[model samples]
Target: MMNKGIDREIDWRLRVFESLSYPTIILLPDRTIIAVNGRYLEKMGVEEEEIIGRSCREVNLRNYPEQKFPCAEQGECPLARAVHTRSGQSVLLKYHDVYGGEGWEERVFSPILGADGEVDFIIESIRDVTRVKNLEKMYSGVRELIDQVVQTSVSGIIAADRQGRIILMNRAAEELFGYSGYDIDNVNIEDYYPPGVAREIMRKLRSEEIGEKGKLPITRVTIRRKDGAEVPAEMTAVIIYEDGREAATAGIFNDLRDKLEVERQLKEAHAQLIQSEKLASLGRLAAGVAHEINNPLTGILLYASMMREKLEKDHPLEQNLRYIIEDTQRCQEIVKNLLAYSRQSNPTRQYFQLNEALGESLRLVRDQKLFLHVKVVEDAPAAPVLVNADKNQLCQVVINLIINAVDAMDGNGTLTLRTYEDRPNRKAILEVSDTGGGIPAENMSKIFDPFFSTKEVGKGTGLGLSMAYGIMEENHGRIYVKDTSPEGTTFALELPLVPMSDVILFDSIG
Candidate 1:
């Protein structure tokens, strides 16, 4: 009865061991397989009798001939290690199946100690880990490729976790923000944005009304740099998802400083073209009107002079005749000015010193009633600043600018005439500044337009600035408002400088 009870207890233990899911086996210290569960026999496709009393190496060889030796000869085998150390040991190994297919498995050996505190039997459990290892390798390769793409992109890329902590910042982002030695890890994404901007962006990215499918449209924003300078950027952002849940947010930014500058220059050029076209149209109209009025004014002047001669000395009508003659002469002068504005006579181009031309213009206007009380200051360079332009046309431009400056000051403030050379550009610059209330903003754009004048009627014909603008253009020069404020206004004239070699050659020829 004692032997029967002992046998039943051993049978109950074997039944419990066979019910386990994993492929499990029991081995003696000699490395002989003493017992295996149904799971092991099913997995190996072999009957229990074929492996029960066989050595572990012999059993492995029957199933996987490619594996020459089992745990005993294999270096650091889990079963051998378990027995030697009298503890649990685990290792990964490669094995082949009955159909000549290979895969990986993790084998764990737990040594069961006897009363002598020595390993008596070893229990081994095998788990397939081939799919898990392959997944890890694929994930590593994909991560490396993604890193390469982000690092090489021209547009800056920034990625942050759902909690707004920065996770990745590409090299472009570092350069855009002027951060070369700054640490970025765990830094909040809001720190890179201006006040309240990051939160607003995230809100737009999350709202379907503002964005589409977790993506925000490209928009302009001012981003503060590491040095506290604000830079304009065009940005597009999207929310990243992993396993159907929100994972992170990523933004792509393009610096717009260069692009915006290019756009501004194009706009300025377009405005200049439009102004030129308008001036050309008005010039044709002025020419026609001046020719029609010139003959009548000449007839009137001749008749008024004859009538003045016909009047007796000290006669009441003599003074009236002189007044009529003087008024007709003034009208004739106006017609001549109109013809000049219409470009009836082409410019006779010549090289001349800009300061001399300016001086001539100032002398012509110095005795005028409008300039009698005004202070005139000249700030020309000591050396000659020569320009290859028509001297008479330049004189007209300088005279018109000076008279306008005097009128702007209402005959009380200062008029400054300055000449300088832009050596790098091979050009000469003439600036006429006035200490007057600057041009009103509403009139600034129309100041050069024909018939657009700020002066009271009869005080101006509104053609002075328009004529000056045309003369500068005809000479291949530029005229623009250099600076203007409530305090004053400065008009600049840029003309091409005559080279010293050309001047010397012309002098020798002369």
Candidate 2:
């Protein structure tokens, strides 16, 4: 009858038990193991013959010595409690894994009661939870790393909620905006930007035209600091979203004051380079014109004197011949002056720069009403081109030329002033160009003559260019018309460049 009842119990419960997910073990009421699933044998590294018909504790102790629970001395175990209560119970168990790591398993005991309500058998199922626990640990480590990065980044970082309440800020953000790490909750992100700027940023963040959706590309904008002073900055931003809905916005800002200053300086340097190139071309042309004019003027003087010598004494054209000789002499003098001014040394001249003088002169006259409609452009080189001249007189010469240029423009046109080194000739060139009706061809020869005025009598002293000519000679420099056309005129000044090896510069470079 006992055999029949056990067979009936096994037939009812064990029919579909092999397909259960957890590893299973079955034992009789006396604690002798009767059956074990394939998973149980595999998990324990033991065969069914080693566990079947043997005391469960004995089988466990023989296979896994570390699992030996002293049931007699200790309180009643989970298995014993399930047996006494004639019900199912579960207790979490810890075990040393085969790889020497610790792992967890939930062991559940379910008793099978017979017709007399006596516990006939116990079935235990084991569920391992080690992989889940490891995954949780990994997630915890990754979260900590992210928090550390947010707090320690080098650029300013800030975040706000949908209502513009400041939610997060890093240490860099505090330093950049001149704020301390206190009462951040009271600060509003809108305060960091000029009025309406913060709203514009949000609009850009939501627009896909600039960057991808929910992002703002790096942009240059003005930022207002805590002290209310505006500052230049570059910023990038992104909208933080949850489940495809706008949640918040975050931005990274970097101060651009120093960077902008550097860019301004670079532009100035580039302008200087352009002036140098223009001067190089001017030098080549000036030299060519001087060489071409000097030889022909000397030849004319020689042939005309030979003709005067060949004339008969007291001839009918004697008086006219004398006038020709005298006029030719004057013409030769003028030609000499036009080609090249005297290069003889002047003991009175001292080293100075057209760069400073021209700049000062421009600044002095640019604000005048005469220039209200004029576009003034300047290009001055980095290296100072020292000239042996009087500083004040050079400044006056620059002022005179600048006024002449603007007057030529008739109150509205571009005026370009440039000063650069003509290194090969050991000279510096100052060029002033004007967009105006050019000097007429007939008036060109008489331009530097004294008291030669094209303007109305009261409107001109008539001595500007002639006085500039005298000053150039005194300063050991050359002044001439570089080019003239229907479009405009450009005047060139060639001043001696003091060599670095000769001048002992106290501060500035030679």
Candidate 3:
């Protein structure tokens, strides 16, 4: 019964071998080919009858086994080594087909031992792994480049979809937005902007409101921070292209904080200098007038007081005496103001709230002739915009500007005062604008020259703007006309919070 079972198993194995798809070849211990499957004969382009009994040197690959191919003469061929060493061997091999096309394959060859305790035949099974290896190489190169590019970029680079889903981001972008690229993927850009800013910016871009012929596409925008604060940024975005099609937008972002801060400091310094100059000029004018006018006024007042003491209440002399005394006192007051204007008074710098200064200046001008026919508007922050400055001096600068605006309007137009901190540079700015006939182009440049005036002779000495300019310079700040249109002109007073070191030293001596 056992012998019958063994014979049955051998018959089943032969049937299984013929049904296998993989090419299998058997070689004799003398390195001769004894048999090959139908698939092997097809691969070699030969009939089984012609190849089955041929020597490896005849039917086997001619380019191998005699030093013509890799691993052949070294006795490292899996088939040869498997039989010679009586063990199993596996290797990769390249073969040239009968038609001369190259093919790469992996093969495992094993020695089949006979009952006599010696190798009987070597069986080899082969497979192809070409496509898999090529794919791995391609993917590896791509991955390495992606890592290198992300690390070396400077500007914040971001690539996202229309839905604001972040698809690609570089290190600079990660730092600028204050969010990790990994964390921002798929997040909306709206999450980083003020309520309407993002939408408005997009609308502008689509409408070509920002970029046109001869215009740059660069934009100043406000970005919303994760902490609910808004930060200013300048961004430039270009439509990416791939194979002549619009792929996505690649945006480069620059944080505006530093720029805005520098602007603020410059503006503050300008305002302070203007105030200083105005005051110094006033002081000098006062000193000159007080000595010259006070003497005459004092004589007038002395006579008037004596006349009042001697006159009866019902007498005509009393009325005239009272008139003289009152007029003399008014002259005295005018001289005092002039004195205040002419002298140099060092400013006590501190964190001053801008809104308060603007309010006070407006109130000072509200009842003036210039404001009588003009509509004045104040668009300033509600918060305390702390800036390093001398409060009194800054207030004087604002007052001067309001008065100048009112004068520019001739008491018959609209005046607007706007104040805010330009966060990018950390500087505060106050813009005073008037809706009046714009300054004559020719006169605009000279408007700040000392004693230059366009008003009626007695109405103005043309000293106000010059004084304003001097004050701004002394305080390490700048004041200039930023823009003008048919409707009116805008005067922008840009100041810095802290005076520069040079400014401090110069002011000390001045």
- Looking at model 3, report the run of 10 residues with the lowest lDDT sum: 63-72
Q: Write the per-residue lDDT of candidate 1 for residues 19-42, one digit (tens) a residue.
A: 988999999988889899999988
lDDT of each: 0.86, 0.78, 0.71
Candidate 3 Cα errors over 4 Å, as ranges: 1-149, 152-154, 161-164, 189-216, 310-314, 344-510
Could you tell me how far off, in angstroms, the CA of residue 73 lies in candidate 1 after the best superposition? 14
What's the C-alpha lDDT at position 154 in model 2? 82
Best TM-score among the predictions, by candidate number: 1
Of the two candidates 2 and 3, the one with more favorable lDDT, higher being better, is 2
* TM-score computed on alpha carbons, candidate 1: 0.75
Task: Give the top-scoring candidate (lDDT).
Answer: 1
RMSD of 3: 13.3
**What is candidate 2's lDDT per residue for 343-456, written digit by digit as tens?**
122335566767877877777767769898999888888887777777766776788888898889898999999989988878889999999999999997678765589898
